[model samples]
Target: MRNLDRRLIQVVPSRRQLEHQQLEFYSFVHFTVNTFTGKEWGDGSESPSIFNPVKFDAQQWVDAVKSAEMRGLILTCKHHDGFCLWPSKYTKHTVAYSPYKNGKGDIVKEVSDACRKAGIKFGVYLSPWDRNNPAYGSGKPYDDYFVNQLTELLTNYGEIFSVWFDGACGEGINGKKQVYDWERYYEVVRKLQPNACISVCGPDIRWCGNEAGYTRKSEWSVVPARTRETELIADKSQKEDNESFRQREISASDQDLGSREILRDETDLIWYPAEVNTSIRPGWFYHEEEDDKVRPLEELINIYLNSVGGNATFLLNIPPTKDGLFHENDVKRLKELGDFIRHAFAKNLLNDAELAVSSFMRGYGIDNVREDNYLKYFRTDDGITEAVIDITWENEQLIRYIVMKENINCSQRVESFRIEANLGEEYKTVYDGTVIGYKRIAPLTPLVTDKIRIRILDSRVAPTLSFIGVY
Candidate 1:
């Protein structure tokens, strides 16, 4: 085990940067031994032969992710109990030994292929602790074994978007240290997926220090001005002053603390973007007994606002069952959730309003503005919409184009809309009649003007809009 040169940790298109672009949306696929026994795998002890999934439909999972507008998916290739989803040459205790379909299928491949087809990025969750493998807690030899398993995962999988490592270190066999070479792990990932973002214990980001998702309204005060590597280490003596410590490297926090409750007040100490991960059910795995415990759409929406809308990325865990398939209840709820999001912000002046830009407006394009700053104009009940935008320049210049984003809420109706420039002296009509939600109306391009204003006309009801950009 070797320590990496702290100076070599250069930031590329890291997780922080990707998050800034794709704002607050990711999927968590919790699939492992927990799905087979209807019990949580605290220590990886489940038999790999039980990994059979007869009617697994990877496409359905991908479809759910795309419909939900999620940018990435993190699969539980190996849980704490150490059961591997894909067959590994390093160990026989994997899907290769599973009883389902006589251990002949690879759940990881199915997911990766489906994600590629759906145009969604893929990531994997590999737990460092393994209660199932006797060698896991057996000291140095175990560390070597662990590295081999990781190498198998990295080399076998195609381009991974991320590799999530949880710091749930368990006791080694006979009280020996479970010492790990984190630098080696980081190097392996860099070699396999050059652009992937490592999570929690890697170079790019660190855990949120706690797994609670809820944060106070003023939590932004806790976020560090910039990420620093020094903050990644957990010092028992500095626990009280963790908030005061600042670092120069970017970091991220994860929250899956409770079943449905997010401790919103704890967000005050977050230094970087927080991630909220919760399962669709009470447990992270699919349980026949918990089949009726599907989370209601309203609860999901509340979680979305309190987490994703609260300036954090939301990681909703949708676990597949022993049959290697998402429960019907899970599927229906995902679709319902997607529809709810689509209808919440559907209609706006940006969608149908005419665009007029002043000839003097110059040096401004959609790509030039910061995403969070750009999203400030549009408002939604849950804060997910970004439908309307206003721009003012120091000098008049020619404007290129105005783009009205598609509505996330697709069920709502828009009655009418109006766009007026120069305080209503000159105006152009955008939408004059009924319009369904989720569909993009039209774009107003090459509008040459300086000052512009917009108003929703005769619209009593409107869906929540995601975004509106002016350049």
Candidate 2:
């Protein structure tokens, strides 16, 4: 147990992925043809005459999103119905054909402009399944068409922060499945917005195997990396079959790809994180009947704690009404949630705690540490699997939230950890978990203590922590 020279396997995220993890929480704008048709999956036959947003206001959308403290918004520029919000030369089913603004107003342009004006990030969701295109099932011809449309969006929109995709594939006009050219799509995003992340159906970010806005207690961002060839074939594969190995589930078994253990023989480890998506309403599209069903402020707070707090980003859907504006109830709920979150985490209780580590690497001592500094480290040894940080508070304080972060530059190493409060001479365990990637926010029952301890029970290698905060 004394081999001190051992090095843990390294798993680091790309620059774009790092930026995405920092966002933590954002909103998804599912406004499109489906909003008017009252259908989650709209057929390609929807006429342009019905697509109108008389009182459309992009600034209002930004106001709602900003009020929620969400980092940005992701607009559904197009859905499965093959309708486009922006005028694209590749198709006639766009805003150009719609009577709104005499076909001159571009939803994408307005939203992007509003996001820039509001100082928030902007993203786009372009569904790959086109039920209207006749060339969809025609192999190369359909791929060419899809790429051209993608190019138009990437080039026209001002600096998109994320390009999202959905794996909703279906038979086309020719009664054959249209093959998606995912690699080509990635290439286009990289060329146009190199800093943007391709989310969910793409590589940089992945779906959490469920759309219920919840993540597992032990969600790890490091997973096996797949080549371009494997990615192309993965979309069409059945999830219940061998494809299950490639997919990451919220409550996946310990042996799953994103589980705690390393699956070296199966796939090379890479930093592919999870994204939890759920709508604010009962449905993704705004419905008149569901107006009163806007999720309560408490529920959204819980989701934010679980998703954004569980080392994964939360993508909450807040659909716009057919009149092109967020519902009044939804806006109020968002503001309430944002206010609660900001107030709850306004100050860190452990900011001035006398922090001490059981063992640390040289040149990584903790003194006058800031919020995001990575100078603190507990270098791992072959015989050592545990490290402890004892914090002596200036005064006994009641705290309900504990935040932990790993120096992901060295990869996600902590597999299991625990937090305890010292009561007299005895210590009581308050919280424990399996992984801490970029950030892990654990909300516990309020506890009053003058001393606290963090113990790393298990790790792939010696672990390194960037920050530990209590609020």
Candidate 3:
């Protein structure tokens, strides 16, 4: 038990963190002066006169997001270029000076209103590095200006789900680098929107180490508290995932982040889950030349199965064109992605499963996992870290996928597990995995079997499963 810190095993996600994890799939709306300039990072010299998306329709953006089964949209309120989507009284470089709506339209307000009206969550991405303001590298003054803009987004928007920030620091207009007030900015988000989860540079969510739709074969949610540091991850692969994709001091992306061996030295632990993000096109912003370069349907599906299914929420960026709408090519791909999700999850083969467990803890039994609702789950007695779950069907059935979810509310504990199917005469391992946090989606090689066995090889505490499903 030397590596098993009860304190670490006992760590749980806060209400807001738990709610954010369940979002599973969401959209990152990256629209700004960059879209028009065909630049990924805009220099602070663009004119607001050329920023109009005359045909811009926030509703269309929401519709595209909703159709793709995404539950929320995080719009880029401002980028490193220092242009504000909403008219901020603190800066003259905002949508207020744009020709759209005759210099009176607020893109932030329009998007937030559309999200609320569509019954989906709204979030904001406010870059910490502002390159336009003259006081950019002046320390406290820039932080103050940043906080003022942050406060405006949180208060003006009805209910913000996420306050996304990136660690993209560079020399500003004055040719000096900024020392960001990370703690101060976190406080403003906490005070204004207590329910919102501060993502990336903040505490609630961690970047999944890349923006290439890449995911770890086994993504773990519970990590040592210090792992969220930008300095440590920056020097290594784990450190370079955020801030406009900063180059890593090291080149490898696969790193052992959370394991019993890794956690033994840590006194503090946290449920800082990962958010996997990538763009639909080659770049974060729309460029007509890259129109045909939209990610293929199969690539998108693989990203979903690996990210959303691998203990991290998937954030796919679907940028708007210069005309203020999703490109037709991107829209077409979104529909395909939506249809694939609906058809794949329409029916749960587990409905026909007769579940039985080797042991149970008092009232917690097999029935808890029968319905993947996250309310109740199957748990074993203390010291029973290893157990077996038997699932059977009266008639032979072909199982294509097996999905498992841990009631992380109870704290993530299962360390390793494998699924076996009775194909002919004996049970054979079909899929194996580690760390099932909020959810884990595993696909089988397509087998016909009447029985499936789940072997929980190890866990931090008595293993618990909120839900086990077959699809």
RMSD of each: 13.0, 3.8, 2.4
- Model 1 regions more than 4 Å off: 1-16, 19-23, 137-140, 172-177, 206-212, 216-272, 351-362, 365-471
Number of clashing residue pairs, candidate 2: 2
Local distance difference test scores for all models: 0.55, 0.80, 0.86
Candidate 1 lDDT score relative to the true structure: 0.55
Q: Which portions of model 2 miss their true places by more than 4 Å?
A: 1-8, 226-255, 259-264, 373-384
- lDDT tens per residue, model 2, 211-234: 666567777777766622334334
- Residue-level lDDT of model 3, residues 401-422, one tens digit each, is 7888888887888889989999
Compared with the true structure, model 1 gives a TM-score of 0.64
Candidates in descending lDDT order: 3, 2, 1
Model 1 poorest ten-residue lDDT run: 1-10
Q: Number of backbone collisions per candidate, in order?
A: 43, 2, 2
Alpha carbon lDDT at 140, candidate 2 = 88
* Candidate 3 backbone clash number: 2
Q: In angstroms, how far off is 421's CA in candidate 1?
A: 18
